[model samples]
Target: MNTNPFKFGTVVDDEFFTNRKEEIGKIHSILSSENHLILISPRRYGKTSLISKAIKALERPYIFLDLQLITNIEDFTSQLLQKTLKYYPFEKIKHFFKSFRIIPNISLNPLSNEVDFSFNPTMSSSVILEDALNLIEKLSTKEKKIVVIFDEFQEINKIDKNLDKKLRAILQHHKMVNYVMLGSQESLMKEIFEKKKSPFYHFGYLMQLDKIPYEEFFDFLTERFEKIKNNGSGLSKEILEFTKLHPYYTQQLAFNVWENLIKNNSEDIKEVILNSVITHDNDYERLWGLLNKTEMKIIIALAYERKSPLTDEIRTKYMLGASSTVFSSLKKLIQNGFVVKINSSYEIEDPFFKEWLLMRRAN
Candidate 1:
């Protein structure tokens, strides 16, 4: 084959997307109804891919944006309006701008002929944000509820301190649009919608995503790997075992394995993993540089097979300092997303990063 079958590092769809049948069905149902949805999960669990696939399947007119890439309120308003413009011709939507409290400056992309919308920096962001959101509701057809997706929705507060109050005030009355708020940061997302003091408390149905099940993921790997040369030798099982069914890492490891197999006709799984670790060494190093002394100690201790980081034996062995310091480091790591608490124990979120740390410690 000229191209690899396994895909990662981007939104997966069509044949590349896998193991979200139930999720897609639920999302489709949610979008079909009047209620909005708040979907939460850690990073790289294929949240965007799942949402995109469902929206595509819905066949409804939609507008999409990722809040992570958005800078502030004006940017939010302009980008939201820009995506909406793609669904409507300039002439059809030109009149809507007149209703905005602060009308955006509009231009046209010469090649795509698509409209480009921008708001004046001097204008009030809240006014523009409210207007842009209302514009989406106005554009919604009575027969169809336009689906508006906000990826990394937890960052909404960074755009404005009172963004939640303003946004919920407008969204609560929106009957013609279904909103999907995708958040990778679970704690912040929960705080926004679960806290009684929050304006958006109980605003939408909350759904949490987990890693794809092992049985299904193993089957997918086997089926895809079979198309390659000499791949039925339990390598798929080994790959799934290595990634533990993390959708992103599973696809990434499978992609690397396929690349090695196709290029060198080699089935050395260990070699592939080492090379994969080496491939991402610089990235991992950058992440490593961000750690403080205590964080560095805690992560290394975790990588060293210190199952329970706070145990007296483990802490003494690693010289992890005072109990409060170790506890604070662990909390920071979890909040920054370097670590996660599963069941009862804490573990590093990145498999390759853990391996990379181990490799460097050995060297």
Candidate 2:
């Protein structure tokens, strides 16, 4: 069987990745100039992939850290130390330990051939954080330029109330390091970067990633599938429209369609969509159960509405209560990743979830 070209739920490299030329260029330019950047986008919109691609093209020494797995301040410090050591050379590592005034306890694991580093139990979180920041600063001085990316950077807010404040204080002075803070949680990311009261207010250039352009996506799909069969342009366009050109879902739906085409060579798009929905039925059902009644009602209303939900007529037709209630529910939905506000209109972020809601309402 041929390998599925479409990639979902992970960082896709060159072959699986489609167009983001403009995004890559902008990020490169920002980092090359020694400027920090904050990348904001909804879940599954390819922010991680874009970061990975840009890092490869940068051809510079860098470290990529995913803050999603970091639960506390200690984890943040340990991860920073570990990832930095992993990316830098052994001579640089020795230099870093000697140059920093305060060093974390380091140990070597004999069986796994891995080094473990952590702060002393007697030290406070603030002290450990200071040591980690100092290490980064010293390391940056050794290299000409270094890039560090903290994926899901918003998680730091949950780790500690003052973590962002502490980070901003140290990171603002680094002369040779470029920081890329990436987050899928739009509201929290904005709170950190956009709000004037926040510690990272205007900390870096803010870039919001949107869906891939339809023409670029369609061409990529056609070229990939055309090798198997000559006539895939129509089907490629159909898939793009159906998925609304969402990066993750478009790839997921195409994976299913490609499988079906391999088996029968005559697969219908609608049937493939149904199969895809069925495959994700349990996940969709569990997602539905997580929402409150008001959220559920609003999502169902959006699934059926042909116009913007912000209109008074649509609000009345859906019996969506007062403007305040609607706004509150919308906020909750957005924070939980169920909805996204695009310019003047709110949309169900997941197209499959919207279809699933429509099916539930019909029954």
Candidate 3:
């Protein structure tokens, strides 16, 4: 199947596109040293794609675990063990695990060819995480540097209230392997790594993944779109410029517009492109429903106006009760991922969503 040049809804591997040479370089620098990294970005900003791509460029044997899959401590332990074993020699899989004094239960599923190991602790034992790190450390000691990328690291907070600090202390001591913790939720990720009182504070280098440049992304997509159509219906410079303003919309818009053009065998793509944008705007009804009445008012107001930090005047103008109410709603919107706070000002993060809000307010 052909892949969209502008992938909005999913993560893309390094092979799928161009650009990000600088990001790859930053990651390379982090791995070159003994330090770990905390990668942060808003949702759908390509954090996962960047790190996965960086792993491919690195020389080390790497394990990429999406922490979203982990639930309890046991699940975390099992996934780490499985990933560590993936790098081991085929003959060493079962036999080598027998030596882990920390892990006790070992069962093999012949059908799936996956072995499971469980660790049983004596009463009053409290070193489960340390032992697990030691197991990974031991795996890394065998002439191979192991780089573990924990995607959506913030979600681990949901696993155990104290698990974040527990894992931090273990990661702080491990010297044999490189770790990269990645998360897209800004507030949670920041609270994990930025607070000095937190266990992970200053524990790793910081890498922020920004969107691709407009012109560069435009040229890349234009070439791809032209090739895919064999120049039957080429993207005009106007449409390309519109795409650059909204990164996520670019991919979704291109997908919708190109699909229609190909289906109808039409040489003119403008009408279909406009219709795609309008359709995307109509999808904002879900966002409106998710927010409360006051949030809806502030959101609609911000969609039409507002250029600075929301103040008393802005709050009154929006018909919100008070500055605190407006501030609370804005905070809620940001935390809920409906909008993003940038430079002390909030803007809807998704381009299509913003367009949808504008249309709804207009109506």
Best-performing candidate as measured by TM-score: 2
Q: Give per-residue CA lDDT, model 1, range 123-154, as digits (tens).
A: 88778888889988998986767999989998
Query: Which pairs clash in model 1?
Result: none
Per lDDT, the best of the predicted structures is 1
Q: Is candidate 2 or candidate 3 better by lDDT?
A: 2
Ranked by lDDT from best down, the candidates are: 1, 2, 3
Clashes in candidate 2: how many?
A: 0
Model 2 pairs in collision: none
Residues 19-88 of candidate 3 have per-residue lDDT tens digits of 7788888888988788898888777767887787788777678888888988777667777777776777
Which wins on TM-score, candidate 1 or candidate 3?
A: 1
Which stretches of candidate 2 lie above 4 Å from their native place?
A: 90-92, 98-101, 141-143
Q: How far off is model 3, as Cα RMSD?
A: 3.4
Separately for all candidates shown, the number of backbone clashes (residues 3 or more apart, or on different chains) is 0, 0, 0
Colliding residue pairs in candidate 3: none
